[model samples]
Target: MIFDSLDVSYGDMWGSHQGMTHPAPLSRAVAARRHAAGMEYAVLLSSRERPLALVESWPRGKWRVYLFDDRSWRMQMIDFKPHRTGMLLAHRNTRWQFSTERERSSFKWDVQETTTVLADGLVEMRTEFAGPRGASTQPLHARTSDRSSVGPEPVPVRLFPAPVEDFLCPAPEFGDWQVFAPFLAQQGHEPATTVVLNDVSVDEGSGPLRATEIEQLFSSGACDTPDGPAVVEPVDAGLLRITSGRLAVSDPGWIGEPRTVAVPPGEFLVTLSLLRTTYGVDVAAAKVTFSDIPPREWEMALRPDEDLGLLGEGEFYGVGVDTGTVAFMDATRAVIEDELDEDLFIPLDGRFTVELPGAESEPNLIAFRAGRGDGSYPVWIGRTDDGQVGCVVVDFQLHSSGAEE
Candidate 1:
């Protein structure tokens, strides 16, 4: 697919940053702003996904350019000495003249390099540079794939002034941003956050649908969040319905819960919810539970030779604890109990005489709280000979959050 825009930046010998950007209508405008602020930049553009132009402004007064004639697949780089007028006027007039060039024979530029490349589907052009400080190579790649499936087409380059107020606003050109967002953010430009909820599977469908398709399926409008106005949309996917919102969160202390939705019988729903903030983003999996499904027929099964011991009970407790296991448990009771607060009963040593959907039938099923603060504690259930229920915990893991101590 043809990318709407691409930006690359590097540090020069003087420690000042230099940037190269491609195919963005706002690139020239942003370059002008940066140039006015004393930052060097090179704005690149492509016509019909071919290298069209490169405007460079460095050391203030001197301007260099690389122009491409798509019809002839020809390219030429030149250094243009500005008029005696101020740098800003010289830069603007030069840009306007280069853009309005009608005939190739009328071009007036000091040629530096020229080459011709076959205009295939996607092209990669490599250019080399050498100076007193060092040598470096820059590569330019462009694609002309269909963009209609994703979103709106890019805004064309216009000489008209860009609206500064809309610089941070969402634009149609920034379609399904694969690179634009991080590129702008790296340049200290804060673009509007685009929240995408993907891998959404409905009970009626066998595969996931795109977020844009889901948004179109549902009616969308504005809603109020703790931070400000947010857009909320309801997506109906046959047997399931999902409501999603896109907004910014200024306060990190805000607390929210997942909304409960009813699901039809004999089906499953798995989806992801995402939120993008200025600092970073948050993601959560939607949890779906069924209340109408009947409980599996079985009972808690005890080992034939194991003795039932008493474990202290406050809010919840378990039975059939071996001495060694019980001692270990008692030593870490505070941490274990704090993690297992959600369960009514914690099985230390026991097996449920029940048949699990995806498990093999066996006895002596043991169970315990597994995983760290961010992981899951899954219960294992098995069947005994006497038709009793036995359960067990097979594995436990602790995940590191990578937080500083």
Candidate 2:
């Protein structure tokens, strides 16, 4: 059985399945097999790249396929059959998911359909196939048609204990949340609104959106810098200690797989622009300043190969926030090569968090609650007019109630 399971029956005690396996998206073996399948399809396309990678047919309602990008074809998304979803693999990350068209429904009918590819790779859902039903761990349950069979039932042999309720990691306790947790949580997804922060490069936000207005945020009682007025609040709780020159802005949960930017190795200050809005307080922005020099320009910061141009006017490339938290950390901390890789449970809303007792040194990371809850947020880079980077900002776009002019 080449990449297939053999249905071998050794009587009642043990049995196997035919041609089946589960998805080990991160497994090297599974990836190799997936690539092999893609390659077989690649050969059929006569070496030309195509959106449709591979296809396999089985009894009715079972048409399996794989989709990927090639030199000739790329797909932003595929309107595929979801009813019979077997397994899905997105871009590089094994543990990935998808969000789809809200107005439309189903596969949109058609055994064969054409869809566009993102080509950028990061946001792509590249492969999916027929799910395999592997051999069961125990014998299949059966009921005897003959009522007489129950009188002499085989001594009920215990199979396995009940499943353990799996909640591997409970939310870290409130006491465990550092002092900053409460401060960070203070600014919330209030007014239940979103603000689109424009790239510093495209500064059309005349009143509040402009980066120029950024330095002037603390207008009256601001620190005077060579560039302009600044309300630079130093993070007394902790700092982002940079051992490696690269700076990374990401969800703290993925620090092990650091995607970074080169910078001078040193300790940097992370500042948050907090504002009291109509509904509640909001974290307008989180910035990591590299140096004292003022930024004269801003650009959408992203991993290399990600095209900012592809994003619409208000659209931006963003990192995932799975635990209602995001972080700024040293680039070196991320050691995952290609292996592709927390809300402290309860909301102690008014309680203290963020500062760990006895934890006084500079931290490798600073994670705070993301706007509202788990979702995606974008990071932007601020640069001096001469091209020196002054700061990095993760704008939650929550400050929709524009500041007074």
Candidate 3:
């Protein structure tokens, strides 16, 4: 769905009109607005109008970014793909330059314009966003040789958002969510059904956890990890090794540009939600707790700088579990990339210690099985009653389906 627009000045960067040429006439500017043109806005002015800023992405060569507002009402994201021909190559990249339409503007990139150079014959050069201004404009030559070539086909980088109506859900009142375990329990269905999402136990914590269960979920051959001689050594000391690592989660099998997170640094307690169904035991979700305080307002686990937004019934951001697996490690190390999806049930890992190359000590990697094989899972940031981060949770939505995988 069309989630974002970088708010670029609409230019005819793509598409051809009848008898028209590149850079379509200004009258067709509306059509051009849907282009991930070779540009990024230094600032966005219409803040009140476009408040939906929630970015999301997948590994299938598609990029979608969203940014949420403070009130946490709506979301916005920009998704586009690169055309094989070099038409929108610049626009095809994942633009991490984020904006909340606020005062500060830090958008940076090479603002390129073609120029004829008699010294090097007809040569094209590029310049910075501001360097090209002033009377003494210094045309900065590219660090690499020019690659201004196109293929036979012109694949338009589809930079557009889906209709807002597409996001409308028959959801309940939006905002901070309560512990849903009680509500889900009320919907009694079958035996061994994946019921537990949040801690439904007698108010104590979720677990002390067992090594056997951890192995089945995270240390199995199905999950690729560091295994040479000490196969289950990490599982033996899983809990101790688990919490000592990073707060960020990751999709170990993710295919494209690695999706990572800069997590809140602190000591975390690792716990699992092993929900049993007719298909056998499954890791429904996983929890990494930092404080005993229950989350007063749960927000999507976005980067610290991302503006928080209230989510509706079916909106979130987390890691994409493509291999039916997800991992949690230190964020500073870029060891994990993640998504914290909703649906409180948990599970999912077997933590192991591995001495990574160039690293001093062995950092823990909590790899766990995702609930429903592979899909985007949301990681929820549980804030303490006092608005502090108490925990981080990734829900697999096992209960949503009928005791199935």
TM-score of 3: 0.35
lDDT of each: 0.25, 0.38, 0.36
Q: Write the per-residue lDDT of candidate 2 for residues 181-293, one digit (tens) a residue.
A: 11111122111122221111222222112333555432234343332333433233256777767787776555554446677777777666654444444444677788788
lDDT for 103 (candidate 1) = 26
Structural similarity to truth (TM-score) of each candidate: 0.18, 0.41, 0.35
Candidate 3 C-alpha RMSD relative to the actual structure: 22.3
Model 3: ten consecutive residues of lowest lDDT: 172-181
Better of 1 and 3 by TM-score: 3
- In Å, residue 80's CA in model 3 sits off its true spot by 14
Estimate, for each residue in 241-298, the C-alpha lDDT of model 1 and write its tens digit. Answer: 1122111100011112111112222222212222222322222111122222322432
Query: Model 2 TM-score?
Result: 0.41
Q: Candidate 3 residues 1-405, lDDT tens each? A: 121122211112223111112222221222222222322111111122332232122233333323333333222223334334321111211222223323113332234232222222222232222222242222234222333533222212223333333222121111111211112111121112232212111211221111122213323233322221111111221331332334557675453433343345543557666554445556656766667665566656664433222111133445777767666666544332343231111233332221222144544455676765788776766677777766666766543421112
- Measured by lDDT, the strongest candidate is 2
**What's every prediction's RMSD, in angstroms?**
25.9, 21.8, 22.3
